[model samples]
Target: MTSAPSVLVVLPSLVAGFLACLGLIVAIGAQNAFVLRQGIRREHVAAVVVLCTAGDLVLVTAGIAGLGPLVASRPAALTAARWFGAAFLAYLAVAAVRRARRPERLDPAGTASGTERASRRAVVLTCLALTFLNPHVYLDTVVLLGSLAHQQAAAWAFGAGAVLASTAWFTALGFGATRLAPLFARPRAWQVLDLAVAAVMAALAVTLVVA
Candidate 1:
C-alpha cells in the first residue's frame, strides 16, 4: 500500500514527464506530415500510429536505462544518422514532388483507389525510416528526455509518463487528422499538400546537411 505523501511526490514528476514529452513531440516534422497524409487518405492509420508510439517507447526506454549519456558521447554516430536521414528526406521530398504533379482525388469515403494506394509494407518501411532515421529523435528522446527523467526522484515513473504522452500524441495526430478529410477530397488540395510536404522535407534535409 502506498501512502498519500509518496503518491503526492510521484505526481509532480509524472506530470513533468508528460509535459516535457509533449513539448518535444508536438512539433511540425517529417514524421508528423507522413502520419497526417496517411490519416487523410485513411490508409493504415492504426498501424502507423502504433509503430510510431512503439518507436518512441523503445527509444525512451533506452534513454531511461542510462543509454542517453553513451549516445551523447558519440558524435560520430549522430553525424552518420544525420547524413542517412538527410538522404532519405531528400528522396521523400522528390517523391512528394512527383506525387504533386499527379494529384489524385479522395473519394467520399476518404480512400483512394486500390491501384493508387501504397502497399502495407511500403508504408511501414517509410514510417519506420521517418521515425528512426532522424537524429533529432535520438537527441530528443535519448539525450534530452532521458537526462530530464534522471532529474526526477522516480525515473521509471517519469518514463511511464513520457510514454503515455507519446502514445496519446501519436494516436491523436494519426486519428484526429481524419477530421480534415472532407477538405482534402479535392485533387488540388492533395497537390498542395504534397507540395508542402516536399518543401518541408527539402528544408529539413538542407538543415541536416548544414548542421
Candidate 2:
C-alpha cells in the first residue's frame, strides 16, 4: 500500500533517528560504566550487550507507542526512580573508589566457581537496575527518541533505526573496550579508570538528588 516515495521518506528519518539515539547513548552513564568494566574483564560481554540492547529496544518501543506522555505525567514515579538511581550510583561510586585504592587484575579466569556465578548474578542484576532505574534513560530513549520518531512518516522504520543505533553502540562499547585491555593491563590504568568512574558516578548521583 505504500508508494516508493513514501518508503523513501523513511530513510532520512531513519538516519536522523540513528544519529539522535547515538548522540544520547554515547555518554558516560552507569550502564556504560558497567559495560566498559565487563568488556575489559571479558566477563559475560555478550550477555551484557544483549541485555542492554534489548532493554533499549523495549524502552524505545514503549516510548514511541505513547508511553512518553504517561511517564511524563507521573512525577511521583520519576521521583522514586531518581532516588533509587541516585542511591545505586552512590554505591557504584564507593565501589569504584575502593577498587581504585586497591586495584586488582580483572582476570576472567581468576574468580572461583561459586564466586563467579554469584558475581555474575550480581552483575546482571546491577546491569538491569542501571538500565531501568535511571530516569534519564527513559527520558532519552522513551521521551526524546519517541517524540522524534512520531514525526516521521515511517515511524516504525525510524524506530528500528534508533534501536539499531543503540545496539551497534553498545556492542561496540562492550566489545571494543576489550581492545584497550593492554592499556588497562597496568593497575594504575584501572585506578585511573575507576577513579574517573567514581567521580562521574558520584557527581551524577548528587545531580539526580538535587535536580
Candidate 3:
C-alpha cells in the first residue's frame, strides 16, 4: 500500500504554528500602544492599521524563508540588532516623556489642521521602525518563530499560517481601538496614555540592556 500523501502533513503543523506565532505577538509594547493611540485618535486609522499589519507580514515571510538561519549564523548581525533596538526604545522613551509634559488642550480647536496627516505619517514610520529597527522583533519573529515552524510537520504551510495569525491580530487591534476614539478625546486621558507609553518604553529599554 502507498504511504499516506504528504499533503496530510500540513494539517497538524498549521495549528501548532498559529499558536506559537500568536503567543509571540500578544505582548503589548510601544508598537501596539502607538497603533492603539492612532485608533483612538481616529487619525489615519485605516492607513496605520494596514501598514502595521503588512509590515509584520513581510518580516514573518522573511523569517520563514531561511533568513532566520542567516541571522543565526551571523553573531555580529544579531548583536548589532540588539543594540539598535535598545537605542530606538530609548528614543521612544524620550518622545513619550515630552508628550507627557506638554499641556493638554482638549478642545477640537486645539487640534491642528495637519494633525491627522502628521499622525498618519508618524504611525507608518513608527511601525516600520519598531518592527525593522529593533533586533528583538527579528529574533522573536524570524529566529524563534521561523525555527519553530520549520520543526513542525509541514514547515512551509505552517509558517504561512503563523504569518496570517500575526496579520489578523494587528488588524483587529488597530480597527477595534479606533471605534473608541470618543473616550480618548479627554485631555487627561491622553496624558495618562502618554505617561503609560513612556513607562513601557523605558521598561523595554532596560530589558534590552539587561538581555
Candidate 4:
C-alpha cells in the first residue's frame, strides 16, 4: 500500500515528466504531420495512432532502463540512423512535392479510391520508419528524456507520466484531425498541405546530413 505522503513526494516527478514530454512532442515534425494526414484522410487512423504511441512507449521504457548512455556511446549506430532517416525524408519530400504539383481533392465521404488509400502494412511500415529511423527520436526520447527522468525523485513514475503524455497527444492528433476534413475538401488545400510537408521533410533531411 502506498502512503499519501509517498504520493506527494512523487507528484513533482510525474508532472515534470508529463510537461517535459509534452514540450518535446508538441512541435510539428514528420511523425505528427504523417499522423495528421492519415487522420484527415480517414485512413488507418487507429493503427497509426496506436503504432506511434506504442513506439513512444517502447523508446521511453528503454530510456528508463538505462539504454540511453549505451546508445549515445555508439556513434556508428547514430550515423546509420541519421543517413537512413535523411534518405527516407528526402524521398518523402519528393513524393509530397509531386502531390503538391498534382493535387487531389479529398472525398467528403472520407472514402478514397483504392489507389489513393494506402495499405495498412504500408502505413505501418512508414510510421515505423518515421519513428525509428530518425536519430533525433532516440536523442530526444531516449537520451535527453532518459537523463531528465533520472533526475526526478521517482524515475518510473516519471516514465509513466511520459507514456501518458504520449498517449494523450497521439490520441488527440489522430482522432481530432477529422475536424479539418472540410478544409481538405478543396484540392488547393491539399496542395498547400503537401507543399508544407515537402518543405519540412526537405529541411529535416538537410539538417540530418549537415549534422
Q: Which candidate ranks first by TM-score, i.e. highest?
A: 4
| lDDT on C-alpha atoms for all candidate structures | 0.91, 0.87, 0.75, 0.92
Candidate 4 residue pairs that clash: none
> In model 1, what is the error at residue 179, expressed in angstroms?
1.1
User: Positional deviation of 18 in candidate 1, in angstroms?
Assistant: 0.8
User: Which one wins on lDDT?
Assistant: 4
TM-score of 1: 0.94
Q: In each prediction, how many residue pairs overlap at the backbone (N, C-alpha, C within less than 3 A)?
A: 0, 0, 0, 0
Q: What's the CA error at residue 173 for candidate 1, in Å?
A: 0.9
The runs of at least 3 residues in candidate 2 whose Cα sits more than 4 Å from the true structure, single-residue gaps closed, are 1-5, 106-108, 111-118
Model 1 spans with C-alpha error above 4 angstroms: 1-5, 108-115
Candidate 4 overall lDDT versus native: 0.92
Which scores greater on TM-score, model 2 or model 3?
Answer: 2
Across residues 1-211, which tens digit of lDDT does each residue of candidate 4 receive?
Answer: 9754388868888889899999999988999999999988888999999999999999999999999999999999999999999999999999999988888877746465622777999999999999999999999999998999999889988988998999999999999999998998888999999999999999999999999
User: Could you give the candidate ranking by lDDT, starting with the highest?
Assistant: 4, 1, 2, 3
Tens-digit lDDT track of model 2 for 132-184: 99999888889888998989877777888998999999999999998988887
Could you tell me which residue pairs clash in candidate 3?
Answer: none
Q: Estimate, for each residue in 87-185, the C-alpha lDDT of model 1 and write its tens digit.
A: 999999999999999988776453546228778999999999999999999999998999999999888778889989999999999899889988887
**In model 2, what are the clashing residue pairs, if there are any?**
none
| Better by lDDT, candidate 3 or 2 | 2
RMSD after Cα superposition, model 4? 1.9
- What's every prediction's RMSD, in angstroms? 2.2, 2.4, 3.2, 1.9
